[model samples]
Target: MEKIILASSSPRRKEILNRFNLNPLIVEAKIEEKKSYNESPEQVAMALAFEKALWVCNKFNNEEVVIGADTIVVLGNRILGKPKDEEDAFRILSLLNNKEHSVITGISIIRANTNIKIIDYESTLVRFRHLSEEQIKRYINTKEPMDKAGAYGIQGYGEVLVEKIDGCYSNVVGLPLGRLDYLLNKFFNIKIL
Candidate 1:
C-alpha cells in the first residue's frame, strides 16, 4: 500500500476516506483561495486543489501520495462560498431556492518527490425546492449552513431543502468518492474496493 496523505482539515472529507477503511495522514494545507477574475469555476477549483496538494507534498519529500480537493457552489456565473453570517446564509439559500445550481469539486492527487499527478473535477447539479422565509430561518438556526458551500449541506439537514440532484451526491457532500477511487486506482495502483 502506498503511504497516503490528505491535504485538508474537513471532517466530512475525512469521513469519506474513512468509508474506504483508509486512515490517511491528515495535513492541513494552509492556503487562501484567491479568485482570478477570468477563471471558470472548474478552473478555480482545480487550481486550488492542486495548490493544496503541492503545498503538502513540498513540505514532505517522500513517496507519499497527497490528495487535495476544493468544492464550490455555482449559481449561474456566481460562486457561493461558505457564509460569513446568518444574513449571508439566508441570501445564499434564497438565491438557491427553486433553482438548479452546480456544485463542482476539484480533486488533485500527487506523489511527493515525483511528477506523477492527476487533477480533475466533478460537477453535480443540485435543485432546491422553493423555500419559505421560515424554512430558511429554521435551517439557518441549525447552523449547518455556516461552514458549507452554498450555505447548505446535502449530507445533513440541508438535504431536505434540496429537491433533486442530477450528479454525484458525494460531490455535494465534499468529495466525489467514485471519481476518487478511479483516480487512486489509475495513478497509484490503489483501489478502495
Candidate 2:
C-alpha cells in the first residue's frame, strides 16, 4: 500500500476517510485560500485544493500520495465559505433559510515523489428549511456553524436546518466518497473495501 497523506485539517474529511477504512497521515497544508475574481465555484475549490496538495507534496517523500480538498456553498452566484465570526454565521444562515444551495468540493491528489496530479470536483444540491431568526441564532450559539461552509454542517446540528438534499450527503459534509474512490482507483489502483 502506498503511504497516504491528507493535507487538510478538517475533522469531517478525516472522519469520512476513516469511515472508508483508510487511515492517512495528517499534514496541514498552509496555503492562502484567496478566491480569484470571476472564477466559478468549482474553479475556486479546485484551485485551493491544488494549492494545498502542492504545499504538502513539497514536504513529503515521493512514495506518498498527498490528498487535498476544499469545499464551499454556493447560493446563486455567491460563494459562502467559513464564517469569520458569529455575526457572519448568522447572516449566512439567514440567506440560506428556506432556499436551495449548492455544495461544491474540489479534490486534488499528488504523488509524493512523482509529478503525478489529479483534480476534480463534486457538487451537491441542498435545500434548507424555513428558519426563524431565533432558530438560526440558537444554532449559531451552538457554534457549529462557525467553521463550516454556508454556516451549516450537514452531518451535525446543521442537519436540522436541511429540508432536502439532491446529491451525495458526504459531499455536503466535506468530501465525496464516490468521487474519492474513483480517483484513488484511477490513479493508484487502490480500491476501498
Tell me, by TM-score, which candidate is best: 1
What is candidate 2's lDDT per residue for 29-68, written digit by digit as tens?
Answer: 9898999968999999999999999999999875788899
Among the numbered candidates, top lDDT falls to: 1
- Clash tally, candidates in order: 0, 2
Per-residue lDDT of 112-177 in model 1, one digit per residue for the tens? 988898999999999999999999999999999999989999999999999999999999999999
- Residue 11 in candidate 2 has what lDDT? 93
Candidate 1 lowest-lDDT run of ten = 28-37
lDDT by candidate, in order shown: 0.94, 0.91
- In model 2, the worst 10-residue window by lDDT is 15-24
Model 2, C-alpha of 19: deviation from truth (Å): 2.1
**Alpha-carbon TM-score of each model against the true structure:** 0.98, 0.97
